[model samples]
Target: MRTPFFLILDAIIFIDVSGCQWRLLPKEYPK
Candidate 1:
């Protein structure tokens, strides 16, 4: 199943604001 657009977008923004690395994101999230 495909992930939700907002969920993916939120993940990216969260990482950006937190200054976290992409590698830190959960594997379940999109690439």
Candidate 2:
């Protein structure tokens, strides 16, 4: 199944706040 738009957005916000690389995102999130 395709990832949801809001979930992707959440991932982006999380990355921005955490200052982490995209590859470091949790397994539950899309790349």
Candidate 3:
């Protein structure tokens, strides 16, 4: 299944705020 737009946005915001790499995102979110 494909990830939702909101979820992807949230993940991006989280990464930006946390200053973490894309690979570091939680498994629940898409890579």
Once superposed on the true structure, which residue ranges of model 1 sit more than 4 Å away at CA?
1-3, 20-31
> Which wins on lDDT, candidate 2 or candidate 3?
2
* Candidate 3 TM-score versus the reference: 0.50
Q: Which residue pairs come into collision in candidate 2?
A: none
Instruction: Judge candidate 2 at residue 24 and give its lDDT.
Output: 64
**lDDT value for model 3:** 0.71
> Candidate 1 versus the native: TM-score?
0.49
Task: Point out where model 3 deviates above 4 Å.
Answer: 1-3, 20-31
Instruction: For each candidate in the order shown, give its overall lDDT on alpha carbons.
Output: 0.71, 0.72, 0.71
The alpha-carbon root-mean-square deviation between model 1 and the true structure, to one decimal in Å, is: 9.1
Per-prediction TM-score, please?
A: 0.49, 0.50, 0.50
Write candidate 3's Cα lDDT for 1-31 as tens digits.
5579889999889978566545466664545
Clashing pairs for predicted structure model 1, backbone only: none
Backbone clash count for every predicted candidate, in the order shown? 0, 0, 0
